[model samples]
Target: MAFHKNLTRVERARLAVTKLICPITRDALRVIPLTDFIFGIYISSRYRYVYIDNPKTGCTSLKSAMAELELRGRKSDLDPLNLEVIHYDSSPLKSFVPIFPKPTLSNLIKNNYRFVTFVRNPYQRLLSCYLNKFDNSTAKDNPQARRMPRGAAPGSFSEFIDAIIGQTDHDMDPHWRSQSINIHYSRVPYAYIGRFENYATDYVTTFHKLGIPADEIPTLRHLNKTGAGRASLHEFYDKKSQDAVYARYQDDFVNFGYPYELPD
Candidate 1:
């Protein structure tokens, strides 16, 4: 047992001593340099950290904030010395599997970086994903396209609800929150959490707690900017379709605190 190097004193000395022989690795380490002290101290100071992104959430804004911190040297963004950020887009499981045994989260927690994530209402998320995939020419031509709109049909929201509710294990990307919930049946201990409706307040409050300056918090960017208003959408959904959709996303509705009012 490597004696859990992140926590133990002996392991720290071993890593430090080992670095002297590995000069190439040592030089590389300088850029994102992490000695045992910095790693241990960082983990101790932070509250908690976990960015559970589930597409549709305002991830770009969060990424920008993190980039700023990295530039300042107050934190590192994939620094050769410290690969603190875990990006799912590029570093897929196959590439990262061999390094799984290493203490990854231990360093983040030690460094005072808090875990965070945002979730959108399932109904709206399904709608956005469906449109982004089929209605758009870019996705319509792609082989990986999951659900293409039928014929000259406009891909009604009703159809979107049916596709999601009527399938099992259908989503290609195994969502982080869903998998975590399935495995643990507990909400992840996020230092901050945000929902689509209240993202502005949540975003500012969360980073403020993390010591980000009030003036620096980025404005919330709505990805689905152009739309007929929620009231119009509410009028568009019929009672039967609404009921079915609610039944489909009951888990998300409950867990994420979305209100579902059956049409009168």
Candidate 2:
């Protein structure tokens, strides 16, 4: 809601009127439905740092880190020199969604705004996703769990990896950097770049560089959402699945400096 800070008083007033013309409510604008097509302009104008959620990339923990840095409020009185994190509950690559068109991540970068993001190794990430789908907490009632989606329970972890890696239904973009290019070696000035493996150190360094105090950082839960539920990386992915994940993500691996060796 505070992301509307870049708007003029008159512009904000006009946006309010425009909202009334559509399905309008306070919480709707705040959190309920996460979409850049609906609220991108407001968010981009207010926050300089944008967290592009590519799903299952330790997003909850990253959001907590941003909140700890006091970037959640509707308005920030802090100096413009500080980082303003813009979080998207959904993927910003609107082309995948029929109702929404493409967003302007390229334009924002061209404007010289500082950007940062985190990435997880794809093989481990896939394993974690399978475990989450079958994790008991997801369905408290045994009967309800029976109604879960197909491929939710592939029986074995290897089967789950085979299913996910074998299928080509989902988006292939890497979650770490905003774009698929050379994420770690970008010549542009980035405030900070983080790895999911070393989140605490990377997070603290980013905030410190931004002049935020150590006390301002909050404790986190679910910090290892990237790979916490996996029983064994070796057992989960076979050589084929490992090679597929690596082949598909080679660009991201080389660009972000992630280890690209196929799992043995």
Error of 2 at 89 (Å): 6.5
Q: Write the per-residue lDDT of candidate 2 for residues 1-264, one digit (tens) a residue.
A: 222436667656655654454332232343222232233222223334544444456655655555544444535443222223323323221112111122233445555545565566666655555565554235644431332234244576555444444333222112211224323224334566676667668766755654556876556555534344346677666677777767765666776677866333
Q: Local distance difference test, per candidate?
A: 0.45, 0.46
**Model 1 lDDT per residue over 182-207, tens place:** 21114234576676557678777767
The superposed Cα distance between candidate 2 and the true structure at residue 130, in angstroms, equals 1.7
Best candidate, lDDT: 2
Error of 2 at 91 (Å): 14
Scored against the true structure, residue 263 in model 2 reaches a CA lDDT of: 36
